[model samples]
Target: MLANGNVLHPRAGRAYVLRGGRIVVSADEIRNADILVGVDGRIARIGEGVSDPGADIVDISGRLVVSGLVDAHQHLDKTGVLRFTPNPSGTLQGAREAFAKYARNAPPDDITRRAERTMARCLSRGTTAIRSHVNVDKDAGFNGIEALSALRDSWADRLTLQLVAFMTPHPGQDLEWLEANIDAAVEKADVVGGTPAVAEDPFRYMDILFGAAARHGKPVDLHLDEHLNPQRPLFDAVFDRVRKFGLEGRTVLSHVSVLSAMPRDAFERVRNEILELDLGVVTLPAANLYLQGRDADMLPPRGLTRVAELVRAGVPIATASDNIQDPFVPTGAGDMLEIGRWTLLAGHLRGDELKTVYSMMTDIPARLMGLGADYGLREGAFADLLVTDCADVDTLVAGGADAMTVIAKGKPVFDTASRPVAGDEHRQPAGSG
Candidate 1:
């Protein structure tokens, strides 16, 4: 029995104690013990027979406790608007056109409503941290930034939301207007971002983004090389800019889908450079799979980065649900486990490979977002955790188990004993989910 006089169960209590669970300290380490969360919302201790008479104990003897999930890339402002704006062609350009049309007429409150719903869904599914890229172009204005900034503060107690000002300039658009708007966005956002591949002058695009980021002392997260054209490669130039600005670990490139189309020798050379530069890569499998490889007539290529090779080469790789039910992805629940499942199948991850796949959602992205030493499930770390029904990673991935309790900073922000059916479990065809 707990100090609060409540029965020991999944929804027992968040009163400073969690006991009798299989705690996953890392991908390779799992221990049966108790976790004591201190008053400062951090893990005070983890061991056997830890007793605290004054604390509320939530017995999870058969449950699996792991770190709270992290989303390295997301689009908060554009979430859950798929029904209003449909992309008939199912291509990148189609998505762009549809979103542009919608954003042109959307008011700030509408954006806030949709974003709030999306974040609520994310919290319900055990996501504790997310890095969202909000549109900063003329159509979106500063509506997204203002709405998401308020949401970030309001949800600060329950979730860590980091905003990146995503500058998406179309062709023939005035560069001066784009740069000025980006400057404004930098003042409001935590990270500076742009789609370099979409810029008419890719180098100049990198210059504007990096210059503003350096001036503002913000990190860079760019959408780079999302196309499958082997002739056009923007990674080298992006790497050169990072080196030139001495922003090695401070830069992240999302959706380098062309890397999967590279030849073996070229891929190896590029992989080595990426490692040397110490850059982070975020593979948005959901959006890439839906948007890319549309023009191929025979045997369309899988639109994904070389995740297996990058993991093998010791490069930092994180996977995310980029767009949720928007014109780009058309379907997503903002669940990292679903993203992990997709990554596993799309990347051909099996056997021992599950460890890396699991890390892509938890530790790896946490590090990339600069969450520091307080992120994981170790003693003396912040008590942000997720307790599920499965005992191991293999079953968690195979079964897509629901997180019974999602704790952030020693507090259970979301918990439910009712196990919802895993939406990724054979609900649709292979690639559709």
Candidate 2:
């Protein structure tokens, strides 16, 4: 560790020291200190009264410095599918129609451009890492994976983008072909993804999905329960498969919206199994609230994954922005903060509870994505960090927090006030007015 005062010369990447910021050293230690970003893109040093004379120092007085946010479940390709209104029926018809339109019409170049814009937007909103799920059925095939893979490579330095290849059922598709496709994706990407609950036989299809993922040595991300009145046994089946394959940290179950309606015992059982398996949970509260409760009777369910109980029980959980304008949820514009805000409101996490909700977008989610070392603002961690206008965690949700600066690997990747565009007078002043 090359250290000078708080000045760190990380091994081989880049180095920039930040001074006088309220440094969050891990999730618990918040102190006034300076940070040294090393050459290998990790934090080289963090201490009080740093005195680096020659190093470049960024003054961050009166601001809060924290780890950049991580969006664990996102559909970057769906941003282009914002043409139509949401389906009122909330049936498979809507999901199929939207998927068809995307399959046929989503141009690769358009996806890359929009995905870039979405990434920039996410960074501007403090998200430094994202796991984007790309559709890769027979329709798009390698084209979808290629586009997303290219985006991942292009944005590697500025932001971390992990691609998940989505597997959907097709007519007469060979099982070996499915395995091959998933293998190709895992070779090129991060995780193997599927929506097994939408399959003709959800349980059997899960066996295929998880088995393939296990074979490829990649994680499994299943779109578990996106609808209300969901088959509660499905989660248990998923956990069983995870245990069977010894894919504990290598599995993620997203959008389990039906858990709010499950009986207490069922919830307890799933929660216990989830903790035992050490599987990650990604709750898309924004999309879930939008899609569910369409046909509710006396009491409409919250439509969120079980967040409080899971967190209280030591189960790792993350929140996500699932869609931009697809048929499932039409409101997202790739904003993880919106998901965080909705999670705070819908999950009833407030005050000190807000800390956990905030971590759902940052530390917890990063750990869920297996990027923990590159996530936090600790020594030897990646220099990737978020500087926020919000003084504390509570205001991060209350004020639509803007990332004053996003440093990726010690290089400044985003700054809200650096570039002043002409005819852009509509921007509000810093902090909520």
Model 2 per-residue lDDT tens digits across residues 272-323: 8888778888888877777678677777777887778787888888888887
- Among these predictions, the greatest TM-score belongs to 1
Full-model lDDT for every candidate: 0.83, 0.72
Cα lDDT for residue 192, model 2?
A: 81
Worst 10 residues of 2 by lDDT: 424-433
For all predictions, the C-alpha RMSD in Å is: 4.9, 5.6
What is the alpha-carbon lDDT for the whole of candidate 2? 0.72
TM-score, per-candidate, Cα-based:
0.92, 0.87
lDDT of 2 at 74: 83
The prediction achieving the highest lDDT against the true structure is 1
lDDT per residue for candidate 1 within 1-433, as digits (tens), equals 4444534532334345676778888888888888888767788888987766667666666678889889999999999899999999999989988998899889889988999898889888888899999988877888899889999898887788999999888766767777877888888899999898888888887899999998999999989899998789888898888988888999988998999998888888888888888889999989988999989999898899988878888889999999999999989987888899888888766667887888899999998898888789888877888877775866665655654777887777777654445554532111100
